[model samples]
Target: MAPKPKKKSSKFSGGKGRLSRESKPVKWIESMAVDMIVTLKKISSEYYHELPNRPDAHEARLFYKNIPTRRNRYGDIPCLDKTRVALIDARDGNDYIHANWVTMPNARCRYIMTQAPLPETTADFWSMVWQENVSLIVCLTKIFEQGKMKTLEYWPTSCGKQFHQKHGHVHIRNVGVRNEPHFALTLLEAVNEKSMERRKIQHYLYLDWPDHRVPICTHNFLQVVRYVDEEIANYKGKEPMTIVVHCSAGVGRSGTLVALQSLVGSVNEGQVPQVCQVVSMVRKQRAMAVQGPEQYLFLYWALTVHITSCCQIPLEAKKDLLKRLVLMKNCSTKSACSLSPITTDQPDAATSSARQARNEDGGDRKRRPSNVKRKTPRGSVTVRKSKP
Candidate 1:
């Protein structure tokens, strides 16, 4: 029979070998992960040939140095001399090239995503982390929570409360690996406190959507609707609310929201195509990755909520609208002509007569000539106009 494993103790610690360990946990994207184990193995063995001078170690550059796959080994990659930065090329080549070290500015977003539960914040949090200069923030989890003195006081704030009040309450959640600062664990153990640093209210309950209620005002149209009835009394701005959305990738959630916004814009303006075109323009700017196929189909339905509005393209009500438009256009054109002083002393009668003469000449020029054959260099005969 196989011998049972001995466990760790004061005298002898058997490490992982002693423990009856199981297989490794599945990773989200194993092919692209720059795991701690691999990163360690790499740094320990590689040569850090000194490059006299190079901020050259920025995230985009360093990312390519340590290749993960044996089949796709990379050499001739410029050596990284700088600290706190590595280059990570996103366009082509190995994906995990810049896994570990990276430029401080570029690393901030990427590093944050690597650690445990995604970081969440209130308005105070958003202000600090927002990088207007580089719009594409490396994907990272952002939490929004209200109330404080909770266990996860480790929960950092990026934006301040002022920015959040107008939008809605702040909340957070983790899909898996309930880390030490677990939501449920924090709620039960921590005391809600109000001190020199933290805010007053008890933390709002963590929201788990789909498992919970699908949010009613998840999209901007819903927000506008809420505003129309004075639901969002303090809401400012007639312009569309800027919404940030991501579901692993910004495509799905963002596309859905943009689609709904298009729907709302159309309904509000009573012009459906106008909104459809608007959504199309946005998708062009940022990929409809938000729409991928599934969400795209749904977005089609969502935006078409009031399709009848766009169906006929509003045929000028009683045709009187067209007439009025034509009359207005004619008047506007005449007014423009009238505004310009006559450059030459052409009498009105002369002008009318000149126009008549031009018209007569035009009619003569437009007359059909008799069909005739003409000799050509090639001795070819074909239909031809008689010599004028």
Candidate 2:
């Protein structure tokens, strides 16, 4: 039998031997977490190098047969059939698309990660959106990136314009469009003319991300995430909705966004978010959820920044806190003093206790005793309960 694994003493510190799934960031109250910024940085650096390589692409072999029809930017990476999205056909029945369902059971977030639709697959993409009842579409790539076609112009760019694909019998009409510095919003109505049913789909195109890397500035990126999250919550439905997210190849920037949303959503839900654990979970559902070490590191940096922002620590206080943290780290736990030796403006425990005692004695000298009755209103009674 395999020997039992050794347990880690600190979750923020990198672990020993093999990686553990349940390992996560330490849970601290909102106020206490500001002190953990140093620890967060340390763990992020360590964990960035510790992430496992992408598992062998066992599904790669299946892509060659569908190369003519599929539009994956990377030919070597194909969605696994087990998790790949399937479309029902009238005659052929159950065709596969280069999309996977990424579900985070704990945070209650689900996403369909797909490749940039080719001109041919654009119709099928809308068909999937219609069938799946997707509430939001998160497009991470532009129509052109690095002077190459990164993503097809799948949606109608102008309001009151209509696009139809005869092959998939999909009709998309743009009703409204809104553009912002961070993202563009398009209100779309998808019609399955065969059934004569219409569905409203919200298209969100994130403008700043690169083809294979994270955004240079995370602020706008996070704003895009918040927009998607708010739209998901605002959606009115009994069934949970799936947000369709795609980039060039569907694994690199796409995975990064999905993982970011998952971790950030988890943090918002009062959970200590674990980058590796969340990435691992996403990869289980969609292979290579976080494509490389850079993307992996970005996830940590983004989370750390997000958490620090939520703490609302002033710039000066942050520097002071960091200095104090350095002092706490430099001091020895086995020192003569039980508490930290770091000097601070706040009074020490002994000083605080003495001050409290003095205040109590002064109150005793000035106060009326409990035996002396206090006046009460005519119609109301007053009761003073003794302190427990």
Candidate 3:
């Protein structure tokens, strides 16, 4: 006689559960109705743009869980002062950071950008740039991000549980995308003891997601971009700074970020074809490691949404944008790096005015309650701390 099947785990199995023991793609709730608000910010010369109004997605988009926020205005410093690809490897209790910068040519010649290496000196590099100001920071490594490779060995078509045990996944979603008890953590307060002025406004992107627990995963990666744009509005001078994009390997996601940046430049610099062309060039330099046709299709959809989101071009103007998209091709990365620093081009009339206002309102520093932190529970569980 066949052995009896083991009893299935509870649906609330410590904040995680399979849709069914039978095995299938995890069920997803479409358009779950999250309240996402949009607001305008002056980038220069009264040139205003619309963006999300929160640090991470709509207040309701947290998958019914609270996202982990910082305490005492510390912890990874968010995007405000970081110059481009500022690395953040805060695992369990261990904290680490690294950043890589590169320049893809536009009208700005001799641009101060170069390719970034994997896992460099985070303490020294990010610290130096964080203390200063930069127009934008780019992550060069994200150009050709091939997702983490697995052996070509055939699988027995068993359960994910067994598959998971064979491979070690450091980032596990439990209390909040990731949670593992550790003995110690290096306090951010102690590291950068002497705090400097934070730029306040910044941007970021997440690439590949080999691990299942990443709060910002493949389908939801766009949320990171949404949140960065939201937090930027409150920044002093409202001047948006460096944007860092990464994936498991930092290639595909980074490429997407660069491509978007190039598209935004089309609107900001008022140079249409040039900006689009530049983005195409970057892609050629780094092959997109996005899996099969579905992911590629997602790219097309994402690019359209991203461009319209930044430019706010009316639906009427989308026809021309669509035409441009059709003509665009892969970005070239051969000589993509190895270029001199380009001169910092000034913003146009409208953008410059907005920058001035941000400067006038800049100096004041704001910090949230030192003890409070946005909690993101694993699976769908939200922890409610007792009110003080």
Candidate 4:
């Protein structure tokens, strides 16, 4: 009998049959979508619960002991000493403010995450901005939300109006204001009175994000992120500028925005979007980033929209996957909507190893809420509390 002939294997086959070149991309996208869905489930059920808590040793000693009057907006949310940005020429040698330097992959000291300035700290806030040469400021909260002061008015409200901080001799004048759909843009000129040096600053206030809850629409938030990037690229500063991002406590909303930006940068660089890893990295620098499960899931959904658009996935497929993910958000329990595992290509070994290492280090730890309410001062009315 003649020997049986061997069949040639196809590059686009998984031992089932050969796929056309066009079908290959479709299969790859489908596989990626499935992996993302699984990752989302893990985030909701396992990974989130296992995130590391803020180390106890990184206490804000300056805020508590030396400068007790610095007045942390949130008592529990400490500004770790390792990452805190100190003012170079602070008056009376008190250089502490509730801000931390947050770094992203391939970008060093890219963002200064900060709390909204109180009446007393406003001058120090402007001083930090001037010293850092910040060209862009992303404000995630309004001055008042739910009739409570979420953040103090840190900039001049009207064009030509000036806010002068005598401590650093920093003067900020509002040059222009423009309103958009979900955000407002204000152009401000910061002048150092001593040296007569001036710097143009763009302040972007996002108005739609509710306290403690994710934005209603992912597209709106994504647009805000892209707009900020566009403004950064247009900057003509003498050196690369660090972006200042703040909300009430500077952890929840600020962290979410930074995390999304980091993930978008990673995707743009042709790397897979690792939601858990990105959040972990941010929290290591600034604690309690991506505050709750909802915010964490929002990151994944936003990335889904971004990745599908970038890869040009079929509209119908994208719609179906997004619809399912959205439904998962409303489920009462994490596993209420069961997603069956798909037999497809696995992610590269490097990604798998990184995830495994993160899990091991996490070790069933739970994130602690840092926004605890402090006692109201004498003769002051009690304000309703909300998340930042």
Candidate closest to the true structure, highest TM-score: 4
Give candidate 2's error at residue 181 in angstroms: 2.2
For this target, which candidate reaches the highest lDDT against the unseen true structure? 4
Residue 324, candidate 1: how far off, in angstroms?
37
Residue pairs that clash (backbone atoms under 3 angstroms), model 2: none
Q: Is candidate 1 or candidate 4 better by TM-score?
A: 4
By TM-score, rank the candidates, best first: 4, 2, 3, 1
Q: Which scores greater on TM-score, model 3 or model 4?
A: 4
Worst 10 residues of 3 by lDDT: 182-191
Using TM-score as the measure, name the better of candidate 1 and candidate 2. 2
| 2 or 3, greater by TM-score | 2
Model 2 Cα lDDT, one tens digit per residue, 64-138: 556775455577666765677777642244366788887765434468899888876776787788777776788
Per residue, candidate 4 scores C-alpha lDDT tens digits across 241-292 of 4789998989888999999887766655455667788888888778777777
lDDT of all the models against the reference? Answer: 0.24, 0.58, 0.28, 0.63
Clashes of 3: 38
lDDT of 1 at 365: 17
Q: How many backbone clashes does every candidate have?
A: 33, 0, 38, 0
lDDT of 1 by residue, 139-224 (tens): 11123324322112333121222212310122321111111111111111111122212121111112221111122212222322
Model 3 lDDT, full chain set: 0.28
